[model samples]
Target: MNLRVEQRALAQSDQDDVVVLGPNPADTTFETTSTEGAYKILGVRPGLTISVFDMVIGADFAGRFATEPCVAIDFLFEAAGQGWLLDADGERLSSLPYRPGRIYIMAAPKGAVGFYDVPVGTRFKGMDIRVDTTLWQKLGAGDILSSLDEHHSLHIASGNGTWVGVLPVPPQLLAVARALFDSAMVENDDLAFEARALDIVHASINAMRSIQPAATIPPRDRRPLQRARDLMIAELSYPWALDGLAREIGLTQKRLQTGFKAMYGYSVYAFLQEQRLLEARRSIESGEVTVTQAAMNVGYGNPSHFSQLFLRRFGVQPSRLRPSETGKYQEAQAR
Candidate 1:
């Protein structure tokens, strides 16, 4: 077992609402349900998280999802939903209903994303693949990252100029994608799923290479910007000042802003908020602190506001992770 998994213990509640908080932030699956649907997110192998979801939620749900730097490949078997792909500034880069019976992917740079308005009684069947940025980049996927949405799905050959990023899955590749669903259902077959995932990535990248790239913004100093990110994560409780963070990491404020987004796919403070929320989720799941304590530990001063942010980021109230909350959670699930 991953030590981080043991330490964090994120999936404690045996609840329908709370998602299993594994090491992969990109395990942040497509659209999670409050009480009407269920998903199983598994880190089937190293640097890989697979989420298979079947959703028909009881109420209207809008999720604010974020992830650490990662790439997501989605196979939407069936969907009647809509959402946007956002940028570093949280601007909508694309807004369209999810195309059903297709495979789409995005590189979650800042990965601050939203998925919602899934109407009642509608079904959603999909598999989401979340891979480490380093792994995908090592597979020569870095150059293609910009074309992938910073936070949403990008479609290709849609006649709209920006929609030219997704690679259409033809018959053969769709067969391969469907095969993965079978392997996911089988017991103890991690390698099978891993191999299929790689094949899907290779196929998508090959198809995507010929397309024009999105506008590029180069990181001025990768090392310094990375250091600044580290400093923020290590001291999230400390109120961060962009200028002070830049000075400490030996970069100008402007360079830090631009370079941080260029490298990490989000602005500095946005990234900090992401890290803080992730830590708070982990802390909440550990059952060692109240949600308020967990929030305060991660630099959030107001518990009510923290709960709101927590629900958005995680798709569940933070209290759901506590062991004591399992009965209520299970009751909700039973409904």
Candidate 2:
């Protein structure tokens, strides 16, 4: 993959409470080697302005829910980078990987960001996009949509502002964004790529708005289609059989394949493969998981096959992306 950055391996002993900022007084690259009971914040840029970019990762020690005390919103641009939520509503929260290309704007008072504390070794990477208020309102209507409250130590009051920057993306979406970005990086077509990426971004936002009522589309009307889709999404490992899923869903294999393709823009197998590859990508990005282990976790019994799939999905070999093995020129520089 064309990952622009790589972070140092996060230590297990790292705390889960406080966040670290800046390698030096003026440096924006924040680093923390421990997380025994605190949180950490890494900034790629030094000065605070209305606009900026960032790459961030977070890990929780107590559990997944331990991150609830933190509040930060990530913005993933179409350009393959994401921005971290730094100071929203006067408080700072650790950054984590969010869905790529999806617009998310959150504002909270202090303690709103506490939910971001993830387990040790968890890492998230993306570009940050920020804008001033004038530009934000132009994108869409601003409104107060949601609010969250929890432990006395953490509290958040949020409102949906005009999406200030780009949004977050899961690895599945990142694969698409990476492909688009690589093509742009190749032809030196920044303008074209940005436009296309923005179009995709708009489509995704519209899709987010297009939440159809499940009641309107009953299980009976789309039984076979939903069944295949559900099975493919639910089971990514251990060799999925078309006939088996079809039988379970009460449809012939041909019907299952055809219906799934017609409804979801992808064959069932292709969707499942993409999903598995996305999971593997996220696991490797976390740095705690090795390439071989990530491959197995995503259902590739053979490392070679996994590598091939990974390359096809992300345009990079799995070995090259893992944080454990370091030999490449760029990797050495990151350290």
Q: Evaluated with lDDT, which candidate comes out highest?
A: 1
lDDT of each: 0.59, 0.42
- Superposed model 1: Cα runs more than 4 Å off: 1-34, 86-93, 146-164, 212-335
TM-score of each: 0.48, 0.41
Clashes of 1: 1
Candidate 1 lDDT (Cα, whole model)?
A: 0.59
Q: Over the stretch 1-335, how does candidate 2's per-residue lDDT look in tens digits?
A: 11132222113214332222211111223233232211212221111111122322333122111112111233343122222334445343344333433334343322222223333343332332222233223545122112121110111122222112122234545555544544433344434544544544444444433322233323343555655654654556758878788888887787777656654546878868876886677667647578889888768889888888888877677666665446232333445
RMSD values for the candidates in order, in angstroms, are 18.7, 12.9
Weakest 10 consecutive residues of candidate 2 by summed lDDT: 147-156
**What are the runs in model 2 whose C-alpha is more than 4 Å off?**
1-203, 206-224, 324-335
